[model samples]
Target: MSSALVRNPGDGTNFRYYTNVIEQVVSNAETGGLATVTRSIARPDQAPPLHTHSREDESWIILSGRVRFWVGSTSLDECDVHEAEPGAFVYGPRSVPHTYQAITSTAELLIICNPGAIEGYFHEAGAADTRSDASHSLMEEYGFVIHGNPPPAPQTY
Candidate 1:
């Protein structure tokens, strides 16, 4: 990133993951020891599955629109669901199962992965996005597990 004064405002790689578009802003390679930042552009109903990471903590900063989320250890049977508006912030520590969905027509989330690990998964998860659930191999590779699948779409999403 130091090579340029700044990344062009509209110059981020957009990866279609699940039913949403994740525009990578700051890659793990760029952050050194900092977190990787991604801009999640989502439509209503788009969401990730209940999953957990064994290493890095996840941070979500709602930039616009509304998002509904569940985060905790009790699993889906018992978990805290929350409604987040613009400027809201949510944190998921390592080992916690969490999931979230966009509740508005347009929801933008600034996602930060501390210790900068999951960024590579976003780039390399080519055909794994088809099913909401991450395969065991994929989970092992990314250090995350899908407690339950989110929904099924084309694997190549």
Candidate 2:
């Protein structure tokens, strides 16, 4: 059997991503301070709260299905959300409040983070009060600002 099948890179206690967001670090980030991997089984209608990081930048590549990404005040609906499917890629810079919502029933996305440890910001984003002012405060502390409007209605595939 492949060692990959028996090894666990992220366990609940050690990693924090949207429980709904399934991810695995195919390669160790410790070696070079970055992470690269293919993540699959992402469900539709799920989204991370609006937030950003001060220390890392994330690049997302789609393997299957579609993802709607929001940048700053412009939502995917307002500013041409990049529709990525196998071979499509989107890059988000550090300190920009953004969030993604799945459009297809099951979407697979590959996420690469430079300085890998920055995922802690993602963990924190998921923890913030997306509906309250507290969320905004946290976002600001990390150099992010939430958009005034919420995400747009889901787009049918």
Candidate 3:
């Protein structure tokens, strides 16, 4: 990825990734700046472990369906839940803990990571290739923090 790349609507490095999420790394780390594009298709009840990136800022451009995001705030009790819809944009600053779930039957998200430091985690975790309800331990190995086992109970606002 020494040079920038253009991916047609249906092209990129696609991976089954982890449970409930499908990922595609559009721009790799070698592209410079570690700026990367990752597309995700998430199904209902598909939520990621709560974690924070140590060196990258992330943004999600909602393409379809609905996503319930827990951002910045540590606990669901902090009342930071947000429901994002198509055409919505959500930003996660570096070092901030964030997590989300697809509330609808399915959701599509375009995530951009600048100065992406965990691209390798995507490769390895995506390789583990397991789709389950358990947490992903790899996130911690990639310099991200997994808050705890089992996320806090869902809070309805």
1 against 3, candidate with superior lDDT = 1
How displaced is residue 104 in candidate 2, in Å?
1.2
Tens digits of per-residue lDDT, candidate 1, 100-154, equal 7777777888888998977777766643447433456856887887787553322
**lDDT digits (tens) for residues 103-148 of candidate 3:** 7777788988877666667756653356332374666666777763
Name every residue pair that clashes in candidate 2: none
lDDT of 1 at 154: 20
Candidate 1 whole-model C-alpha lDDT, 0 to 1 = 0.75
What lDDT does the true structure give each of the candidates?
Answer: 0.75, 0.58, 0.71
Q: Looking at candidate 1, what is the lDDT of residue 129? A: 49
Candidate numbers sorted by TM-score from highest down = 1, 3, 2
After superposition, the stretches of candidate 3 with alpha carbons farther than 4 Å from their true spots are: 1-4, 20-25, 127-138, 149-157
Worst 10 residues of 1 by lDDT: 148-157
TM-score of every model versus the real structure: 0.81, 0.62, 0.79
Off by over 4 Å in 1: 1-9, 127-134, 151-157
Report the number of the highest-lDDT candidate.
1
**C-alpha RMSD values across all candidates:** 5.1, 5.4, 3.8
